[model samples]
Target: MLNSINTNPGALIALQNLNATNTELNTAQSRINTGKKVANAKDNGAIWSMAKMQSASSSSLNAVKDSLQRGQSTIDVALAAGDTITDLLMKMKEKALAASDTSLNTASFNALKSDFESLRKQITKAVDNAKFNGVGLVDKSAKALVFLANADGGSFTVNAQTLSLEGLNLTTALASFSTVAEAGSMIGKMTAALLTATNKLSALGTASTGLDTHLTFIGKLQDSLDAGVGNLVDADLAKESAKLQSLQTKQQLGVQALSIANQSPQSILSLFKG
Candidate 1:
């Protein structure tokens, strides 16, 4: 090629090649630093958009998980209280049964009556205290609870249970173990109330199990969504590392090539000097 100081074609070509190498090297370095091939919309618009959408979904599931966890904890508190009420009912049954003995003396009967009343009051206390996150499952404060199940606005509901004395059909009149006949009547009521409390506990236990199972499913689903986002955007560090090394070497070579091309005009100077 003809050499000119004003326009050396070889230097122009070398500079163009070097610029191309520099661009590629910059891209490799960016990937290595960010650990992502498509870190932004400029990287790959379509893939980046998809990855952003999936990542948003994965993040939203965090809220859903929180809802489920709160629901689970609320149910756990109710279950604990229900179990306590069940045990207290069993003890109340024993107290009422003992009070039913007609041969018992007045002093003994009064003492047994006082004991039964104390147990009944304890059951009320358990029902009142079965609350979490401002929700009471056993006290009839909340009719039902709904928890977010997924990113699509799906939900699960846990029906509330009223375990109060009146709710269980165990009237305050039964709390009056003041006489032998009343004591005898309380035995039958206690049995029925015990059955009701046991059934409620069984149902609550099932609800808790369902919550646990769905929580596990949500966790796995979130993991899958995260993996999907990674697949769409994450760069292979090993491949990027190798590519960066290769590009660095090519950049050095490109600089040397441009330097040699720039010196081509010096040969014309040598000819003129001789």
Candidate 2:
């Protein structure tokens, strides 16, 4: 049986052509405004899915970067405080040697000992107070000195154990040492503690250097990810410019074609007039 719509082929064909042309015109307009061919997942499901995957990876990396930054800052604070403590210990040694002077009596030596003792307390205070975001780096709080991040956005536990200076009890260093031998013994103990601090600081410094290198790599990764995202989403200005020109011309021509198509129906009116 002949379809009822086929009875008026001219009107049906004209309407169909108009709808198709209108769709193309709208697509071109959308691309022009958004500067993206795939504005949403519906544009191309597979390609959009891949872009989302890449986006998810980038997000994970970004989170890692934040933690790495915080770790680096914590190390930096610890490093600075370690340096000051190293200097303080050296000064304390100078005072210890001054106490051993033959001319200095028990009372004079006691004054020097008091100053050295005060410096030791200051060193302990510095360590106890060394904190980044309320997490102590040098105190008994943290077991490790360095933190490393893994690829899956989870932190990989690296052995960064810091040496605890808590056990170096220096209470006796405060009391007056009468004999030169007593002062010398105190100096010896203090020197050993200083050496230990130096060694630990060296280890911490090495770990911090490694973290700095990792941070640099992460920064590069972020840059690469940003460039990749741009490649996927950003319109190539040169290509889009050319496309814009072509679409403009095609739109003008499409309007003209539609105008001409509409005129085909007017021919029936002309026939009646004749």
Candidate 3:
């Protein structure tokens, strides 16, 4: 190779190698700092795009999980109210049966009627208050609760059940037991109301169970998506660290080689001085 003072090819080649080494060292250092192999589209365009899409999917599933949890809470409140109403129905039925006996005096019959009315009123209150997030599933104007099942606007609905006073035929006006016949009829109505409440409870329980199962599936799906994204974009810190050290060493050697190549042109001056 001709060592010329005006243009040193060896120095130019050494400088080019040094620049390439510096570029590689910077990339390894960036991976180490960010802990991601594909931090941006420029790093690995296809892999970065895929990872971003999966991450967005995981976020959408997280919203679904939130909806499921809220739905569970609503169902839980309704179930609890149904249980209390069932208990109140049993007590009201007992009062009605005691009032049906012919031996009971007027005062005793009225006392039993009063207790029955109180218990029936309590059932109405229970149904009225069986609400969560401003939604009552066991009320006169109850509506089905809808929850998102996925990010794509898919949904599940929980049917509402009315357990109000008029719904159970245990309203204040109809709760009187003036005769044995009336008391017996009241007992039958109470039995039917109890059955209705229990059936509603069963349905709500099933819905809650379904929500729980969906939530579990969503959790697993999010985990799988996250793992996939990580696989596509996450950097191997150990490997990057090793690469950074090697590149640093190579960069130092490149600079030294360039320096030596530049000095070669000065050696040409010695030929003319003699």
Candidate 4:
């Protein structure tokens, strides 16, 4: 059986060519409007996957940076508490010096002992209260932040050990300072307190510095991820403009060629008679 051609062949060819031209024009328009070659995942499968990966990385970096910032803040709380503890120790030392005075009588010595013990109590209390959102770097309960080894898809941990301000080695603090002798136990209590305060201060300072270092690293990582995302998905205006002009030219040429193809069947009409 022959395929019957009832319609004008020239018109059919013109219609087909026009449809192709229209399709090309629609594609060019889409790219121009969206400012991206792969506006949808369906446009370019591999490129879309790469873009999604970049986006996820950028988001993960931001989250890590935020965690670092919070960690730094937690360290700040510990550091402040450490400073207070040192101050209390200094006050205890002052009271000890007063008690050491040779002229101090029994009542005066007793009073000095009482004041030094009170100050020691205050330091302990201060350490206990210094906490940021219940994450105490000082006062014994300190926790380190953990992150995945890979940004996505992994079972891993970035373990930073919890440190404590309450770990000060205050040996024989109240015991040695309780007695008022010729040497005046004030010196011993005060000395021990100073040593404890010193170690606590050092630990907190070290921890704070480490927090700053980690935060800085996280910030840099965020910046790097942002750059990668830009490279992968962001438009280059200059390049896009050039491409736009080239596509416009191609689109125009395509239309003209389609018109010429439509004329092919028109030539056949010259041999036809009614």
Give the top-scoring candidate (TM-score).
1
Tell me the alpha-carbon RMSD of every candidate.
Answer: 1.7, 4.0, 1.7, 5.0
lDDT of 1: 0.89
**Backbone clashes in model 1, listed as residue pairs:** none
| Model 1 CA deviation exceeding 4 Å by range | 270-274
Return the lDDT, model 4, position 197.
60
> What TM-score would you give candidate 3 relative to the actual structure?
0.93
Clashing pairs in 4: 138-165, 142-162
Best by lDDT: 1
What are the lDDT scores of the predictions, listed in order? 0.89, 0.68, 0.87, 0.63
lDDT score of residue 207 within candidate 4: 59
For every model shown, the clashing-pair count is: 0, 1, 0, 2
Q: Mark the regions of model 3 whose C-alpha exceeds 4 Å error after superposition.
A: 172-175
Cα lDDT of model 4 by residue, 21-119, tens digit: 566666666766776667777787887788788778867766666665666676677778777777877777788778778787888888887886777
Name the candidate, 1 or 4, with the larger TM-score value. 1
lDDT of 1 by residue, 92-199 (tens): 889899999999999999999899888888888998888997788888565888999899999999988878887777666756678888889888988899899889
Sequence-dependent TM-score of model 1: 0.94
Model 2: weakest 10-residue lDDT segment is 156-165
